[model samples]
Target chain A: MEDVYMGIDVGSISTKGVIITKENKILSSEYIWTEGNPIGAVKKLVRLLEKQFDKENYRIVATGTTGSARKLVGTVLSATVVKNEITAHAVGTTTFHPDVRTILEIGGQDSKIILVENGVAVDYAMNTLCAAGTGAFLSSQSARLGIPVEDMGEIAVKSQHPTQIAARCTVFAESDLVHKIQVGHTKEDIVAGLCQAVVGNYLNNVGKGKKIQSPVVFQGGVSKNIGVVKAFENQLGCPIIVDPDGHLMGAIGAAILARRNKERRVFNFDVEDMEFITREINCGGCPNNCEIICVYRNGEMIDSWGNRCERGDVAARKAANPNAAAV
Target chain B: MDEIRMPKAEYNHHEMVVGIPRSLLYFRYGVLWERFFQELGVKTITSAPTNLKIMTNGSRRAASEMCLAMKIYMGHVESLIGKCDYILVPRILDFGLRRVMCVNFEALPDVVSNIFFESPIRVLSYNIDVSKKLDERRAMVEMAVSMGFSHGKSNKAYKKARKAQNEADSRAVKQNEAKYKNDGITLVLAGHSYILEDEYIGKPIMQYLNENGVNVVRADLVDRKAALRESERLSPTLKWELSREIVGSLVMHVHDFDGVVLLSVYPCALDSMVNDMMLRKNRITHVPILQMTLDAQTGTAGVETRLESFLDILKMRKEVEAGNGREAEA
Candidate 1:
């Protein structure tokens, strides 16, 4: 059997998992709603992917994880490499498009722009201060418009003239969206306008002051919408490339990273059967009051973090050395 | 910094408590100002650490256009209302003719006064206008006189407090310099002392950095006098006193740090401009920068991800540099 690597991206809204061979060929993949439970979501994702590829054909040698719950899920899986979404996305994109100079990723909760130089991420900016230009905004708007998010792209592409909505702030975007609806604008035009607004807001805020060189690749959950892709191309005055497996890029990147590393953690397929539990405990050691997540396998603690001071070590080390905290 | 333990000296002046809102210049001068009051036989109390309630209450009272830090400061001032005899909201004016603090700093006292116009809390007034020859020492002296301290007592108190502050600043610089000797990644958290030292605001970032196996050296840890002299080359016309030091620290110790993390509170007029300017100057350098803007809405997940990515990038670069050195030697 050939060796295979697994990568799981347990994001806030959705969880994605991908299995790939040593040659970068994706053997199996799955995407599912996280539904506020990352571990359960990832387990279901893995179970679904497990059904896609025959275990006899490839042996899962190592695993990696990324996204908002990268640390938590990485703990559950005992991943070989736990990377952030930015590095994962960069590696995933550059693996396929080595000459790609820029990557514009608008995910469910946040958006980021990665500037690549010589096939490496030189600089990047994630939407730190606001959730103005994100998939959540579009999803909420889609609900308000009584249209499925999946069909929003087709409706937007049908619009001959997109409405002009405010793209400065999320508050303004929401109000402007309602105002356009009250003014009797066509649904297609309004939907297209939203795509434009998201693009404009992202460029004005997250992409502000960024040196955006061409051969730009746009990905993430937002890339699934054709309207957003068209808007980006129109505003950038250049073509925006959208890959079919854009949403799985972070997972793909994680798998690639796992393959590059010298050491590998033997992945257990029986993670689905194992008892994994998480508890959030506040560290009272200092004023930082870091809410640490303690992960336990069966009755034993595996790992913990979230403290900023040496005082918090009593709580963090409680996982492996249970007697350290003195109960 | 809140993490650093200062002298535990206390005063028995129970008649009055001076409320110091832990925002703006408080991080830099809180210890000295508090000590000066203590020396003059006056007790001092600071507002509780920043929280959502303090932040929202402040935002509601302040103008929408005010920066996040200014708004948080107002909230802190509000927290001290009716709890103390006076609230210290220093009116720090221009440093010199061409060198100035942020316009917000210059207008902060007025802003606080207007916000609490109907309230009973008396906002302490200390005008630090070095451009007009009224330096920080003179302002402190005048403030002490208004509080009924004798000229000789005030002079002694100021000297004692000044000595403590100077020693603390020097100690900070020395400790930061020691971090340079370590063979690992070091990040200079470039921001105003207030934004960087606030337990509720800036402390978490420092904590995260510490836990992530990176040493954090505050840009303000560098001596202001020396930093100002070194900063003139970066931008001679950069008027903001703090921003000049932030930019200057890089020029002074650019090679010491593996990367620069330009941390700022969201909606800061001074920081936004300075961050861009500083990044532009260091564009050609190998050192990567992570510009993080913290606001009331900021979460730990986002910050952790960004910092992790930055560290990974730095590690990769270090490996590449090592490989290059080996090839060159061969």
Candidate 2:
């Protein structure tokens, strides 16, 4: 039977799943909105991917998880290889495009520029604090303009005289956009200008002080917008490569990592229908008072985190022996 | 009712005590600080000794990319929030004379205020421009005036406090000078004295080296005048006052010391750039220099291992040199 590897990218905004064959051929993939529920999103994604799997030919061997929710999803799915987003993305991208120099990734809430040299990520910069160039920022602006976010790119292409908007921050960008609209700028021009602002903001902030070389691949949610892609191409004076499966690159990367790690461990996709109860408790050990989260399974404490120190061990121990005397 | 004396005019009793975390500028302006606050009649509270809890808490509160010292400073500020009416987190722009602090120090007050917004501790600040004659004296007077102290009282207090602080610092400098006069492998540590005094960060390394029979000399322990002079020999263009002093001490005592350890906080942009330049440009053939960056996550075990290996290398080199000297004598 052909071996199948499972990869899960559990990001803040969405959870992605992919099943790939031994030869790195993507067999099945699914994207599900996290909806603030990672566990539910994973379950839904797994079910969708399982439906598309060739059950007669493929046998699941290993699993991998990446992104912000990697730890939680890894624990849930029993992933063999869990890696950070940077390593996973680098590995996944280099496997396909070995000579790729730069990887520009702009997602729902954050954006990152990874500088690759000789198939290794030498340095990288991420913009987490700013939201002006992010997908969420675009989505909100789309709503204000009474335009569907899906059609933002198409509308941007129609703009001949795009309005100039301040892209320093989300607040400044929003006010600038509003002022431009009030001054009777065409919707196409405004939308196109917004896309340009995102590209400009991203370059000025995330791409500062870095040598950005050619053969650049722009992936993640924002890569779907052709306007931004054109902006990058024009600004860098280099062609921007956008894969058809660019949105699923993170999931694809996770799958590639899983396939690489499958030699060590075997995986089964039959997720146990176990209910997990998560609770948040405040740890008042110091003035900082970090609020810790404890996860319980079947009336027993399984895992706990959020407290910055071992002071939260008391909460964990208390959860373990509820009938015992309190500390 | 007929003899009700006019109630004393309700004096604005808005007395606020500002707490300054004694980690960064505390060593630099110990005298100036005491005098400035004393002149204004404002109570000052400093955080307790640096401990593991403070370090951990500070790291958690700070952004992932902040330097190690700033994180510790945050923890110190967090400790002082409820204990004091206001935290005297002064935003220093420039010291004039082309001397400037790290960008992190300039943004510290703003960052701290934003980070701990839930806490009701007020921040006090003063802008210093020596070029405009707005010196430390003017800064203290301005701070005092803002705090409702009369200009005359603030000036008097500033003078007295400045005198007291200078006297105390000179004594410390003298003590350190005496300590360095001993016959031993004097390792001159060129870094902030607070970093050396910090329990979780610098104190451990100092204690470990001392226990291993190595005499530790602090670059910050030297006289300011002598250090400045020494620094001129090392780098004529070294603009940072603190870094100049450290480099100056290293140049003067490089031959006297067995090895030099240039300690820096993690993610420190200015220090990393300057220290890297110093390590590359200086050709001190006799002494080996170790560049170590301390962060919140830095474990003592890792530090101990590095120190042990460096010491071993130095010992082996010394032994080989001694053997050659004996052979030459024969």
Candidate 3:
């Protein structure tokens, strides 16, 4: 059987999975909302991908996971590699666009700018202390405007004139948008302005003081928005490449990484049916009171993390799996 | 302004236990303080390493706008309450005009005294403002005398403490210098000693870097006069002493390390300006820099992600430099 690889990107808002052949060709792919339950979401996501996967023709040899919930999903899938979304995105983008110099990623709760040179990422910055210019921000503002977030891109591109909305902070932006709406600005113009604000906020915050060169790839959930794409293109005077599979780049990158790994572990699709429960245990052994996350498979603790000291480590392990050996 | 009252107990000063909060200046002058007190035959009790309970209590007592380090300092002060006879709170203004510390240091004694005014807290304090002609030795000797030690004894203790501090500092600098000989990816950790050595805030990052096979060099380990002089090459107008040392160390040894990680606590005024300048003026050096601003939040997820990505970048670049770029994919 041909060797295949599986990759999963479990983010806060969405979960994406993809199965790829040895040559990095996509064999199957699936995307679903996480809905705050990463364990349940990954199980659903794997099942969806399994349905599309050609089990007889391809055998998954290695697996990888990425995004915010990468560790959680990686544990559930027994992934060979668990990597950050930045590295995943950079690797994924550079694989498709070898000369790409920059990656603009606006996820559900965070935004980042990665600068690449010679097929390697050189510099990067993530949004600090705020979630102002992200996909969640756009969707929430779209809700306030009584329009679906999916329609924002089309409506934004229709505006001849865009209103100015302060995008420094969400609180200020929301109040500014309210005032503009009351002042009788067109809905399309306001929507277009919001798109511009997202770009402005991104450039000012995440892309601050960095050199943005050509061959830029904009991925993540917000890349689907043509309005923001237009704004970025207009501001930077450079064409932004939005791959059709842009949202799955993290997953695709993960799969690519899995394919590159020397270790081999055949992935089982039946792992999706396993009952995985994530429980938060406050290890009160010390004043640190570290909240440890213990993942259990049908009440047997499989993995744990988040303890700062060895005392908490021992306490959490004992508390999480009472029947298991002390070691 | 009301005159601050010092608690007057008839007990001998040598028998009185002094509480040193493990925050801020403690990380800088802890060895000196401890050694001096020991020489004076006085007992000292240091507060425990920072924890979640101390952090929460500190947050509740601190002003909303205070930086995370200062808030943690407040928590440390609170932890020492009712535990010792007198809490040592040093007011460090500046070594010189251009070497000034953040205003928080100058205001520490007042802040601690005012915050714990009703808690029966007696503050044992010292002032060091070199521009005002009150040097460290003078300040330290005066403080010991005020604690009822003889002038001769205080002078001897201060001298011994200064000698001990110098040796400790030089040892650290030598250890840092030895890292340059290692044939691996070395990164300079540029931050204040307090933030870089704190148990809750900076220890985890250091541990992670060590576990990842990265050689860590501290920017504060270099000679003070040499670092301050080197800093003038980067920014002549740079004032903060700690910031100057970090910049000087980074500039002096930029070519020695593979990369630099500038760690700063959230909302730090000095670091905000200094780090921004460093990033903008980094055109002189061709090294990758990653800035991580930490807060009181317990989650290390975001920090871990950034660190992992940073290491990946460094490793990939190294591979490409070695002409093995094709094999380093992903």
Candidate 4:
């Protein structure tokens, strides 16, 4: 059987998975909407990948996970490694584009800009407190514009003049968008302006101060928008490299990381049958009342966290142990 | 009904209660201020650590564009309103020429008073304007005199408070300096003492950094006079007192640390300038720098992920330096 590595990235808006051979050749991949259910989303993603997999030729040797729900999904899949989006994205993009100096990622809920030097991440900043210039914001605005979100990029590029929208906050931008629409501006102009506003907001907030050197790669769902890509190129005064599989970079990076730490172990796919549940309980062991979370597989406990004292460990052990009463 | 015994005084000082809002200046002067009041036979009370409700009240009172730290300070003041006979909010002006504070510090007293015009609670204020010759010591004495204390008592209390404040600062400096000798990786965190020391907003990052087993050092712990002098190398004209001191310490001590984290509260005009200056001016080699800005939302998960990624970078950098370059690609 050919040795292959698998990676899964369960994000806030979407979940993606990728399987690659030992030589880093893509075997199969899947991307699905999380729909607020990361667990279900991953299961669906895996099930789709399984249908596409040449099961007889390739055997999954190692698995890794990334994204915000990485820990949960990693534990469920018994992934060899679980990493954050920044590291995963960096590794994935740098592997494909070795000379890339910067990575600008705007996902469904957040935006980030990473500055790389000599293939090493030197500095990075992420948007905090607001989702002003993310994929979700663009999609919501598109829905209000009486156009499909996917069609925005095509419509946006048709305009010769793009209206200016406030990039400081989403509330003001939305109101300005309405005002622009009421003033009988062309739909194409408004669409193009929205893309420009996203780019402006990103540079002002996430890309503030830090020097953005080029050979840049833009990734995540927003990179799929041609209008936004055009706006970024125009604003940055440099063309951005967006790979066709940019949306799957996070998962691919996880796969590469898994391959880097190739471990010899069988992935228990049957464990999917076991019921996975997480429970949060306050440990009254001390005055702090640390909220302890226990992840259970079927009726037994697999892991627990948020315990400040030995009491939490004791509770976990008792739950995991068959003879001891469930705490 | 108080359990502690009271010291002998010419006049009864039991009714005197000084409320300190645990905001901007409180983090820097709370120990000395409380110690002074205690020595004067006056009781002292401070507002609770920041929470959502208090933050909301502060947001309601402040203009949206104001810095997060100032808004949080306003919230602290609001929390103490109607709860204390007098709330202490100092008007910290310039330390000296070209050494000015952010405009918020200079206007804090007026803002609070104007916002709470109908409130019965009196604001106990002390002006610290070294540029105008009304220094901190003089202001404190004047405040004590206005509070109806005798000259002799106020002098003695001020001296004692000064000594106490000095001792407290030295002890902290010594404790932090001790981390320099640790065998593990050390990272210098440059940020406001209030933001780095606050229980509600700052504690999580502090706890996270400490638990990672890396030796942590704070720029605030460095000697202020020496730091101010050290900062001249980076930018002679850059003169925000605490920021200058922090930059100076970073410049002086960046060699001893493996990395630097520039932490700031979002929308800070002062930090925005200083943070950029550090990125452009600091001539350190190979040490990775991360600029983090905290907002109202608890972006703890994202911050933690970034911190972990930073630790990974540090680990990888160390490995490469140690001749294990094979892992660099991995």
Q: Using lDDT, give the best candidate's number.
A: 3
Candidate 1 — which residues are off by over 4 angstroms? A275-327, B1-23, B34-88, B103-124, B130-133, B156-160, B174-184, B223-238, B251-258, B276-287, B297-299, B318-330
The digit string of per-residue lDDT tens for model 2 on B140-163 reads 677666656678987888888888
Better of 1 and 3 by TM-score: 3
How well does candidate 2 score on lDDT at residue A235?
A: 85
DockQ of each model vs. true complex: 0.26, 0.02, 0.59, 0.30
The per-model lDDT (C-alpha) reads 0.82, 0.73, 0.88, 0.81
- Which sequence of candidate numbers ranks them by DockQ, best first? 3, 4, 1, 2
Q: Candidate 4's C-alpha lDDT?
A: 0.81
Q: Interface Cα RMSD for all candidates? A: 5.5, 15.7, 2.1, 4.1
Q: Per-residue lDDT tens digits of candidate 1, residues B1-330?
A: 111111223212467788999788887887798889889888788898876567778888889888788888888998898788678777788878657888888787777878898998767777888866888888888777666667889888999999998888788889876777777778888888888877767888888788888877888778677888888888888888888887888888888878888899878888888887776676556467888988765347777788888877666556555554211210
Per residue, candidate 4 scores C-alpha lDDT tens digits across B166-236 of 89998998898788778777888879988988765677777788898877889878888888998898889
Q: What is the DockQ of candidate 4?
A: 0.30
Rank all candidate structures by their lDDT, best first, as comma-separated numbers: 3, 1, 4, 2
TM-score of 3: 0.96
Q: Model 3 chain B, poorest ten-residue lDDT window?
A: B1-10
Tens-digit lDDT string for candidate 3 (A1-327): 898888899998999999987667898999899999888899998888888988788899999999999998888888999999988988888888899999999999989998988887877888885689899889999999999999999999999999999988888999999999999999999999999999999997788778899989999999999999999999999999999999999999998888788878999788876898888988888888899998888777889899887877787778776767354
List pairs with backbone clashes in candidate 3.
none
lDDT, candidate 4, A193-271, per-residue tens? 9999999999987887667788989999999999999999999999899999998889999998888884655564565
Residue-level lDDT of model 2, residues A128-232, one tens digit each, is 334568888898899989999889999999999878988887788888889899989999999999999989989877675567898999988889999888888
